[model samples]
Target: MKTLLLAESHPPTLEHLTGLLSQAGYTVRAVSDAVMALEHFSADNPDVVVLGVDLPRVDGQHVVHLIRGHSQG
Candidate 1:
């Protein structure tokens, strides 16, 4: 599946998740913040989004809601 990964600022965790997702045959676009994630979302139209709860500006729940809204539309 195509996946959008809203990456954690913590390097190791992001790297590990990226490796696992890649291994599972997911095409991932990693973004470090909600703004970037949202920007990428419009263009990428990923099948799923994996968001970090501790993200800056916007949190994971917010991201989830945004994705769900997009899905509904």
Candidate 2:
């Protein structure tokens, strides 16, 4: 099964997206903050990442950079 790393600050959006993606058959790991998102990304190494631009603690763009830096792909 494929996995998705979802980093969204809005609670409703997060819940909605998680449900939608889960129904679509992807394993979703959702986080409300960028720091936790990055941590989860490192631990889970998800196949895809869905990020909210406006994030707390760190920001989506930085998280993307971190992922790119660590990822072989």
Candidate 3:
């Protein structure tokens, strides 16, 4: 099974996407803010990541940089 990390700001969108992805056989970890997204990214190390640029707390762009930094060191 593949793991997916989903970071979305909108509650409805997050739920809808999560449901769809789950049904498609992915192990999904859905979050609404960048902090939690980063936390999950570190802990889960998912195979795929779906991020919303308008995410709260830290935003998606910053989170991407952080994730990359973590991956490197």
Candidate 4:
């Protein structure tokens, strides 16, 4: 089974997306904050990540950079 890391700040969007992904058979981890999202990404090492551009603490672009950096190092 594939894993998905979902970083969405809005509650409704998060719920909706989570439901859809779960129904599709992906193991999903949903987070409202970018920090938690990154933490989960490191721990889960998800096959795919769905991020909201507007996020708290850290934004989506920065998170992508972080992921890239971590992958390289």
What stretches of model 1 exceed 4 Å from their correct place? 4-6
Residue-level error in angstroms, candidate 3, position 52: 0.5
Backbone clashes in model 2, listed as residue pairs? none
Ranking by TM-score: 4, 2, 3, 1
Misplaced by over 4 Å in model 3 are none
RMSD of each: 1.7, 1.3, 0.8, 0.7
Better of 1 and 3 by lDDT: 3
In model 4, the runs with Cα more than 4 Å from the true position are: none
TM of each candidate vs. truth: 0.83, 0.94, 0.94, 0.95
Q: Considering every candidate listed, which one attains the maximal TM-score?
A: 4
Better of 1 and 3 by TM-score: 3
How does candidate 2 score on lDDT? 0.94
Report the error of model 1 at residue 8, Å: 2.5
**Model 3: lDDT of residue 20:** 100
Q: Assess the local accuracy of residue 33 in candidate 3 as a C-alpha lDDT between 0 and 100.
A: 95
Question: Lowest lDDT 10-mer window, candidate 1?
Answer: 1-10
- Regarding lDDT, does 2 or 3 come out ahead? 3
TM-score of candidate 4 versus the correct structure, residues matched by position: 0.95
